[model samples]
Target chain A: MTVQEFYEEVGGDYNEIMTRLRTEERIRKFAGMFTRDESYKALVQCINDGNAEDAFRAAHTMKGMCQNMAFTRLYQSSHEITEVLRGKDLESAKQMLDVVTTDYNLVIAGIEKLLA
Target chain B: METMEKDTILIADDAELNREMIKFIFEEQYNIIEAEDGEQAINAIMENSDKICLMFLDLLMPKKSGLDVLRFMNDADYIDYIPVIMITGEATDETDEKAYEYGASDIIYKPFAPNVVMRRAKNIMELFEHRIYLERKLEKRTRQLRESREKLERNNEFLINALSSVVEFRSLESGEHIQRVKYFTQLFLKYIMKMYPQYGITNEQAILIVNASALHDIGKIAIPDSILLKPGRLTAEEFEEMKKHTIYGCELLEKFKQEDNEFYHYCYDICRHHHERHDGNGYPDQLKGDEIPIWAQIVSVVDVYDALVSKRVYKDPFAVEEAARMIMEGECGIFSPEMIDCFKLAKQELFAVTEGKFSFADVMVK
Candidate 1:
């Protein structure tokens, strides 16, 4: 997938962020940090460790990263899991982690393809 | 030097992308400090408390959360010092409420709008800067007011002492007489303060008493030179005339009294009642015991002591030992037992004054 295809698939306002930043260089720098993020991996680790608070922090951070990158599908999934963990409903949040992971993986694959 | 320095902004987030985006927006206008996690954010805030003017805190991080940082700021009283804007992925009522409760100045959703973030940060920084400016201005004004009040008090003291010297010169008493009386009054008052905490006689009151001692003989100014300057013993009529000096002094100071001028009250009491005996056998109204103001009692003992030890037209100067003996024996006038005791304790200092060694002006300097 090209950068255009990735933006189309994620349904993010790429052109808007670019215009707001006033330069493609800034957009590329933002995208570089986005590609290197480890919030999803940390979220999965916290879920496996059964640390509800840590899991909440991890999911919340992942959700924030997704929003900044304008990865709508992944942001929505992460937000759901973050809310569930915030409520201290660990079991429910654990059940939703798979959906979050799938969306996050898809975003990562699209970014990798675009960057390549 | 300070004007040459740049304002610092802190960006605290677990996501490098979030930090970079915010930094890119503010780097041109401010000096940026980045903290990768909540713990680092708190440490940065602690170390650079005076330098950092604004913060962009992420709601979630590894060691501590943005809410935790806010709580720390609240506990440490940094909430008002540094304005914080929480960066979050999604906006929820729950997170918003918690952030505000913890003292977050404002919250911004992620996907960081470059313009909105810059505008919000600038506005909050200016607001706090203005607040700090007003606070410093108020402090400086308060200091100025206090200094002027102190200066007025010092000038008032100088005028009172100048007037007292005029009365002394007119009465044919040595200028040193007023100095001796003032020193003896301070010595006695200091003992009273140390021994009697219940009286609540503050240092300020003691200074007023000493100042008023200068005017204790101001009524002598009103007497005729034929009577006041007489070197011989006075007739019964002439003695009665001399006794009226206390009444004259009180009336002279009466016109100067204002509601808040406590010094006038001290002067009035010392002038009218210093000649009164503690045994109720003394002149004027013949006020007895505590009926006479404490200031009057203090000045009364010092006046008689100075009179006995200083050479006058009517008599030769007595030794300090003889003066103390006469006062204790009630030769000059009956005094309070407590006053007599403090007088005895101050015998050495009083002797120094009579010998022209220690001066009351020294105490005034202190």
Candidate 2:
């Protein structure tokens, strides 16, 4: 459950981020945040409350965090939900929320495995 | 390692984790300020405009959007002064165009690669610092140019005054004679400026007229010792030679004429035409009425008044009252009726100035 294993588990582009940051220590610190991040929970709550604007904001934020942390699968699913909610396509966004939640769960589990 | 203070960078986002991540990335290089919402971001930018050099703005936050902050910055003209980079998780073409239109320096998508964020932020900060350096340099250069111009103007005044004093020394007249003439011309020109708005005299022209008045008798430098120093009245031929001083003065000043040198033109007019009579009967050009240059007309009245009140080798000085009468009576030479009127009106002040009863510096200070 090292940084390399986490990158491999989530299929994240570790090398790409490391090229600029140039330090595994910094990347490790960034990856460690995923364990405590609540962006996905906020997104789910907004979707449940039928607040498409706040839901879009939450999804968008999670998408960015996933991208930066190289959580490619979760980033893609969150990106899809963000676009739908941003366009105010509430029904489509509501449907896509399930897909986002599934990817979010996979990312969380992968990070937990790497940390353990 | 160095003792210098770090530049401030403001990170504004609704998410605490996002703020912390960004702060961790930049804290080593910059002094970081955190704002949890767009409103706090704006407040930080307003309060620390001088200190904060760069800003990372979250596109969407509770209460106020990043675009709202940008709108306020644009309204206050703070956007150009402080560079802003928009951070958005869901960037679209519409939002991108609007952010740029509102003066966003750049846009960075959320979940940006750490390396990409670092490079982009560093490049933008460097670019803004370079721009500020250029602006300060430009301001300093402009100030230096203004100071040099002022120095040149002072030098020009000093050289002209020195040359005018040399002319006074050669004419056997007291240096104060030229000083009185200059002051009298300034006083008369002031009255002309107020009473005759149609003349269109500017302050610059009035100052040039005063400066040039010091050289009104410069032609006497070319006059012969016998006629110039003669105690007795000049015969007809000698008188004719004496009158050529106006033409000689014009020739002396005409040598300095060059393109766009308005001061030289003033000197030429005052020296050449100051003796010309308003009634078309005076020596040299005999320029009558308005045909005479206004500067010369002003100098002519002051010169005659100064000459009459100051003792010359040829005759004793007359009283200011008697000189004013002779001018009005057309005994010395006919003048512009307006000149005569201004002369009479300014007589007491003129005498006070000439006789040392009042300082010309007081009139100048006013």
Candidate 3:
């Protein structure tokens, strides 16, 4: 769908949202997040450290963000993972994480389509 | 009125009471569906590809266990991004680990508080959403990187094949001839560059020169086969016709010589005067001495040496030592005195190379 049509469907003022999101404050804040949150780069770190708990915690937080933004596919996939994590199950959590990896790609494709 | 837009959760278990109680608790807040077994759970997940946001699955059920359901989802790739909360009467680390391996999202032991269950579900859902966002960001970056890499590989292949094909059509020989020439040219260039560091050619420059050498006979493609493949000596007219390759080769290369292109001049020079004599008796316009392009001259010596030693349709292969002696003699006075001396010094090694007694890799050693 056209970006404008998508915005209309979402009941949003497309141009206004774009302007607000592109403002210096938001871009700076977004860029600053790389350093501000150690958890933001958690995927690479989790794999490196072999700490499933940390990975699970990071995934839990990211899943929450996906839900809030209505990224249903990502939210659902990652949610299954944190559920496995809370149960103190590492192997299944890793498996669920794999699912997240696949669906996460699809979510990215959708986002790119929207941006275009 | 519009639908309330509530989250949909599936509760799958063999026990009707367990399903009913969970449904009753969540029905007000979430749209609920029920499945009685692993088979039913898999079916439910498949049916609700994206609509279902959460699942409460019982550990032991008829037909298939909860772990079985998880494995099915993981294997078939049927599960959506929804969170799964596995319900069990006896939750052990072994069972939990196995379930998780199958992609169970969460585990809740039976006879637990509804509030705790609800809270865990809410937390998991929140976390699920955020994880999706960062993942999407990373995926977008990865896809962009993949596309650019593919494009680069394609362009590299296109240019290499285009350049080599020009050499291929020049004679009756297969493309393998170019491959061998390119390989040996690189080996010799690498050896000399290392042994004589004062020459100041970088590895990259050597590689480009080797690539350029692939087009050494590109102009011969325009020559008539009667002249090119003629086994016997050529008449003066045929010889004169053959000499025009240098001019044709240069003119062919000139068409691509844009001002900003770094390699154009190198290519143009090599194509035009590779056949020029050091004493000024060779080619379309032989200026002689140090006037010949060094790259062309370098190629000329190697090309003639290889051509002499290799078996052709018309002539038997010359002995490597004989070929080396002929190159050293410089019958046409086409090569410089210094190059002839270099050929003499390197003759044994070149002989070994042509006789298949030395490897291309061995030749590359400084």
**Candidate number with greatest TM-score:** 1
lDDT of 1: 0.83
Query: By TM-score, how accurate is candidate 2?
Result: 0.76
- Residue-wise lDDT of candidate 3 within A1-116, one digit each (tens)? 55445434433334543343434333223222322333325743674576766676566555544432334555577678767766767777666667777766554444444544
Query: Over the stretch A3-112, how does candidate 2's per-residue lDDT look in tens digits?
Result: 77777777677776676456777766666676677778888888888888888888877877776676777888888888888788888988887887777777778767
lDDT of 1 by residue, B1-366 (tens): 132232899999887877888888878888899999889999999999888999999887778878888989999999988999988777789999999888888999877678888888889888988887788788889999999988988887788778888878876666877777787898899988887676678999998888899899889889999998888889999999999999999888877766577888899889999999999998899899989888899899988998888787778999999999999999889998888888888888889878878655677663
Per lDDT, the best of the predicted structures is 1
Alpha-carbon local distance difference test for all models: 0.83, 0.81, 0.66
Question: CAPRI band of model 3?
Answer: incorrect
lDDT (10s digit) by residue, model 2, range B1-366:
111333899999887667776787788888889998888988998888877878988887878899999999989988876889888765579999999999998998765656677888888877877787788888889999999988987777667667878767766666777777888888898888988879999998888888888888888889898888888789999999989988898887767666488888888888888889988988797778888998999889888888888887778989888999999898987898889888877888887876778877655432
Give interface RMSD for all predictions: 1.6, 2.7, 17.5
Candidates sorted by lDDT, best first: 1, 2, 3
| Backbone clash tally (model 2) | 2
- Using lDDT as the measure, name the better of candidate 2 and candidate 3: 2
How should the candidates be ordered by DockQ, best one leading? 1, 2, 3
Identify the leading candidate in terms of DockQ.
1
What local lDDT score does residue B342 receive in model 1, on the 0 to 100 scale? 84
User: Candidate 2 — what's its lDDT?
Assistant: 0.81
- Supply the TM-score of chain A against the true chain A for every candidate structure: 0.86, 0.88, 0.59
The DockQ of each candidate is 0.68, 0.36, 0.02
